[model samples]
Target: MTTVAEAASWARDLEALAIRISPRFCRLEARERARRYLAGLLAPLERKNGWQLAEAAGDASPDSVQDFLARMRWDADAVRDDLRAYVVEHLGDPDAVLVLDEIGFLKKGERSVGVQRQYSGTAGRIENCQIGVFLSYAGRHGYALIDRTLYLPQPWAGDEERRRTAWVPETVAFATKPKLGLTMLERALDAGVPCGWVAGDSVYGTDSAIRRTLERRRVGYVLTVTSGQRLWPGTVSDWVEEVPADGWHRLSAGDGAKGPRLYDWARLPFRGAPEGWSKALLIRRRLGDGELTFYLTCAPEGTALADLVWVAGARWTIESAFEMAKGEVGLDQYEVRSWTGWHRHITLAVLAFAFLTVLRKAAIKGRGPSRLGGRLDPADRARDSTPASPPPASADSRHLRRYRLVILAKTSSAESKAIALEAPYQNR
Candidate 1:
């Protein structure tokens, strides 16, 4: 485990990086204000006396943190673009897989955008919540968030009063998560990000529009599909000729001996399929666990088998990213009610997580201790030649020192002064 000092140092380093990425982040009334907001979320620090977590983070007052976030230009789109550029410049490999996924935030009330009695993947049951569609860039260098969209419920978008109350823009409209995901892909491609192929789950795979869009853009995709999804074996002409005048037939296949019957199989191009549909492979696999699944892809006609398998497997990275962000990095722990607060909190959480990820990778590669964890290591202290005594200790003394080092190294005398303007909220 990392020492307290080391953890605090890491937090400071993360704050500095956040400032560098968006200087406006540091300009928020107090310097440590933003740092405290992030540290409280990232570290397992206990709440301070007389300060509620929300109040301490500046979310209580009128000109509060929520308002600040609402007025800022650090919206989802801008943040996504900045992070995308960062990943490309610092993390991208020549061959990288762009992973797209949507995570649903289970909200309790119906007022928030897209909060309906619907299925939330997060809760694994029907619940009221906002769903966020996200796109991520993942490869050996590191993973960085690329895009996100708040799925507005039809009621919120269709009602002018509710829309105004939520501060949702007039142009905001209802669109399925998959549709929003497609827009994210288009934006990334328009920016000239070097993405080789796209990978997603059955939700995206089942959407003919998404698959066709990829085909239209000449982008390769490896997407999972339901066993019932139609596919044309060999060629389109073959399927067209085989279908009777009454269209296609759904064949019944047995799940087991004297067992439940299900669709055996069939591959056909989408009905009324548009032109430019690339020749894609239809594949099925029987896992060692006895689960059967299918996938569709257009990974060049004769690509090596190994390369095809690798592309198909890349989608798991996004899942891992989501798991780490929510579980380890506290992605869903914000207690805000406003849309702006939610967005800002999630963005900051993403940045904090990304910084830690970069640091961990650097540490593993023997690049030295992370700037956020201070320049010292517990292991290093063990090797010191000074006469040994009972090791220095405090509940949070180690972390406090590391945090101080990071702040000192990243914030200059002038920046420190600017940060100090917020006074009492500096550090507690």
Candidate 2:
């Protein structure tokens, strides 16, 4: 748990960094508003107007906030470029994992850009929502958002009625999630962001073009492919002697205790297939449930087996990132109806999550928790291990506690007395 002074210092540091990135960013209303929004996420307090975020340390009014955000143009390309620069400066690693994922925001209505009745990962059902394809950078420290694009369904982009109704931008075009993902990766690479390999789930893996594009760029990748995905085994010279099999057999190497042994794989070179080809590794693994499945990958021949396994596992981090953002920080809880607001909210939420992640990493690096925990007796430690008890009825707990006091004062005579007694002793 960081102290107020420490958190304030961290906010100021981030603000300074934001200013250094682009002085104009300091003037941008979106940036200022986003900063305040992030602060609010760090320590929210209920107010008459709902939740008033932490006041900007340096006097920022709604007008200044709006002007500041407005000064920073909201173009996707520009934002992506800025984010790429940030990643290069802060988290650049040649072997970093570039994770491609799409998160859905369930919208209550159809007015948002690209909002339509569709399969929303957030809602887990068909709903009106906006999907954002994001590229995240991850390494030893943690992950940060690198780029994002809103996916416009064909009906929203192609239908004149829906387009006009949703206020879709004139330049908005329909792109499948994978296409958007590839575009994001291309932009990141073009911006010189350091990345060694790309990873994604089956949605991106099943697309041969995406894999081929990565191979064309000589980029390594580990992507999930359906067990049914067909591939030819071996090189052109080998295939010339025998007709390629429709499917190759997969074998496992390890036992259940050793983590589901997997092997019995085959490799195929792109040159041999009648259709354009990409080198692929086909693997078979036997499940404890007695099910057998195969997987395909376009990983390079020299790629270490450990590296491939790690890349495949990187997809789960994005899932955790999504869960953390939504569950912990309210990623999908925006009440705004416009596309601009939606993007703004989501961006701030990402930054907030990043801020907390940095704090957690720093704490762990300093060994703060373990060191502090060690100071306690075993009984005390066990007691602390249980879920935290609700804060005592003390006025100085936190702003939320104070707010609850104010609310309770209006409810009942006994509660009002408690509130009255608690107020004066509370520290401002």
Candidate 1 overall Cα lDDT vs. reference?
0.56
Which structure among the candidates has the greatest lDDT? 1
My TM-score estimates for the predictions, one after another, are: 0.68, 0.67
Runs of candidate 2 with Cα error greater than 4 angstroms are: 21-31, 44-77, 233-278, 282-286, 290-294, 367-428
lDDT of each: 0.56, 0.54
Top candidate, metric TM-score: 1
RMSD of each: 18.1, 18.0
Q: Kindly list the per-residue Cα lDDT of model 1 for residues 38-156, writing each as its tens digit.
A: 55556653532113444656555535554444654544445556666655655554445677787877767766655678777767887777777778776545566666667777777
Task: Report the lDDT tens digits of candidate 2 across residue range 328-395.
Answer: 56666665544555565566666556655655655645633222212345774465334223423322
lDDT of 2: 0.54
Candidate 1 structure, TM-score to reference: 0.68
